[model samples]
Target: MIKILLVGCNGKMGTMISTVAQNSTTLTIAAGFDSKTEGNFNYPVYDSLTNVKENVDVVLDFSRPATLDSICEFVLNRKIPVVFCTTGYSAEQLNKIQGLSAEVPVFHSANMSIGINIVNNILKTISNTLYKDFDIEIIEKHHNQKVDAPSGTALLLANTIKDSIEAETEFNYGREGIAKREHKEIGIHAIRGGNIIGDHEVIFAGKGEVIEIKHSAISREVFAVGALKACEYVYDKTPGMYSMDNVVNDTIKF
Candidate 1:
């Protein structure tokens, strides 16, 4: 069994992961690190990683970006693999994560849902085939409590679409004024309301035809499950950076 040191064990995603892991035959929550330590968890919860005493196989993090430093420190000290499920990290913080991969396996993804990763692959094909004739726009929706705008998954899709096409493409987040839509621009829009698990829609607009590709996450369990799969993928791997694409590709081959 993979013994996971779960960060942010009191949050919604953390609790969901704990519940999912409990049902799995090959996964167990060894311990948890969270600022709020009053939650009734099956495993022990500590306010910080430095206080953890469990023999953990991997660290699965769903905490905020503010916790990156401590997580990195723990990884460096313990030389263990980690799967980061949190979003909204700054470019500098991302560089820190990349650096950590050189010493320990690191799995990071903007959105951990396998379905989103599949959609990402499909968008590459669609963007390459239809960019000349169609204008692309991405709309993403999430819960109101979410702090990030345009969602990282939306940006991931936008970047995937942009990179696939060989042109000077730029992102336009929510148009304004009366400017004509440029063929070289990818429009991104964000919607926040209620308790939306997640929703993303990509539109390819032509003169008379509009082709839309969409993915809707019905529950947080999808991400919790995906994170566990990522943990299993990197449990014994060498030090390196990994993503959901790697996980999906490996599963496809199996």
Candidate 2:
């Protein structure tokens, strides 16, 4: 069994991971790291990773960007693999994460849902085929408690859409007064309210036809399950950086 040191173990996603792992035959929660360690967990929860002594095979991180430094330190020191599922990291932090991969395995993604990664591939094909005839816009929705706008998955999809086309593609966050859509720009809009797990819609507008590709996450369980799959994939791997695309392609799955 793979023993996981779960970061953000007291949050909704953390609890969900624990819940999912309980039914798995090859996974176990070794321990957890969280600021709020008061929750009743099957494994011990510590306020920090500095004092952790668990025999963990891998780490599953869903914590804030603020906790990244300590998480990196722990993984580097222990030479353990890690799956970082948190988004909204600054460019410098992302560089640090890539650097850490040189020493230990690191799996990071903007979003961890398997369906979203499938949608990523779908957008690539659609963008390549529709580039000459369609104008594209992306709309994303998330819970009000979420701090980042444009949800990382939206950016992931936007970048895939941008790179698939031969011509230059620019990103427009949203339209304002007197602003009109440009031929080479992809518009991204964000909406926040209520308890939306997540929602993303990609609209392709053509002369007389419009196509919308959408993915809606009904619950946080999808992300949690994806992270668990990443944990399994990275558990015994060599040092390298990985993404959900690797898991989707069955690179590590037997």
Tell me the tens digit of each residue's lDDT in model 1 across 13-45: 999999999999988999999999997899999
Q: Give the poorly placed runs of model 1, Cα more than 4 Å off.
A: none
lDDT of each: 0.93, 0.92
- Across residues 137-253, which tens digit of lDDT does each residue of candidate 2 receive? 999999999988888899999999999999998999998899977889999999999999999999999999999999999989999889999999999899999999998877423
What TM-score quantifies how close candidate 1 is to the native fold? 0.98
Given candidate 1, what's the lDDT at residue 115? 94
RMSD of 1: 1.2
Estimate the overall C-alpha local distance difference test score of candidate 1: 0.93
| Model 1: pairs clashing at backbone N, Cα or C within 3 Å | none
